[model samples]
Target: MRVRGDDLVKDLKKLRKGRGILTSSIISHVGPALGEADCPLSDRELEILRMVEEDRTATDIAYALHLSAGTVRNYISSAMTKLDARNRAHAVRIARDQGWI
Candidate 1:
């Protein structure tokens, strides 16, 4: 399904008001956890994380980096495992909190 530009902007605004804005408590919670976790992101993983930080989707990242979507997914999965994250969003949070992304 194609998302209209206006609708996308509206959704982003809603997200910013809700979960997208990172508050102090969220930063505090994620900070300490990062130092204690085992490092799981390889060079490729780091790249994927950076792209995700820029709001790129898996397909976008794969296409930009000339990698397969499966490979990008694997990198994300490995990063999540290493960071002990529950999901991709969580992993990005951890990575950002640690200044790893």
Candidate 2:
């Protein structure tokens, strides 16, 4: 593309102006990532809670996820600690309330 010198400056300014506009749609599209910015749980811990939401036992989740039941329990314990939850059920509820699972 070729343009007169004046047209080149005009096009450059237009592009810069467009880049400056951060629309709500853009933010909403990026909401999931930004939402977790303050989240204290690890990704693995979050994954465990999500499975916990499905009423899956640690052994069941471990079998499906190929992790040990002990590992799954560890993740749940960590998530509970981070969320200040009293137990597995509370952890799942807190995670759901925070939109983390």
Candidate 3:
């Protein structure tokens, strides 16, 4: 950030102006703060993501669980929303990393 003599003031001003607001990752917490539940995801959502982590297809999981495929997908989608995940894999990753599943 060293600028020559008189240019230092102008350079610093420009740098300060360009320094945008800071942001951080949003994490969902459970426990007393939430007033209920141990994790953000429900038991069913955790179960589905665990199966997903094992590389099971949605239809396969539905068959094994005696639930509809659409229901399984709905659980996955709900988990994704709760974990702020971009996709099914991301949801699993987040849940696993948090030890939720």
| Candidate No. with top TM-score | 3
**How are the candidates ranked when ordered by TM-score, highest leading?**
3, 2, 1
lDDT of 2 by residue, 2-101 (tens): 2366754554565578843322222223335567435678888988888998999999999999999999999999877766577899878766755767
- Stretches of candidate 1 off by over 4 Å are 1-39
Where model 3 places Cα greater than 4 Å from the true spot, the runs are 1-24, 28-38
Inter-residue clash pairs, candidate 3: none
Q: What is the lDDT of candidate 1?
A: 0.71
Cα RMSD for predicted model 1:
11.9
With candidate 1 superimposed using the best TM-score fit, by how many Å does residue 20's alpha carbon deviate from the native?
32
Alpha-carbon TM-score of each model against the true structure:
0.61, 0.62, 0.65
Q: Listing every candidate in turn, what is its Cα RMSD in Å to the true structure after a full C-alpha superposition?
A: 11.9, 15.4, 11.5
Predicted candidate 1 versus true structure: per-residue lDDT over 63-94, tens digit per residue = 99999988899999988777667778878887
Q: How big is the positional error of residue 58 in model 3, measured in Å on the Cα after superposition?
A: 0.6
Instruction: Candidate 2: give the clashing pairs.
Output: none
Q: What is the lDDT of residue 43 in candidate 3?
A: 87
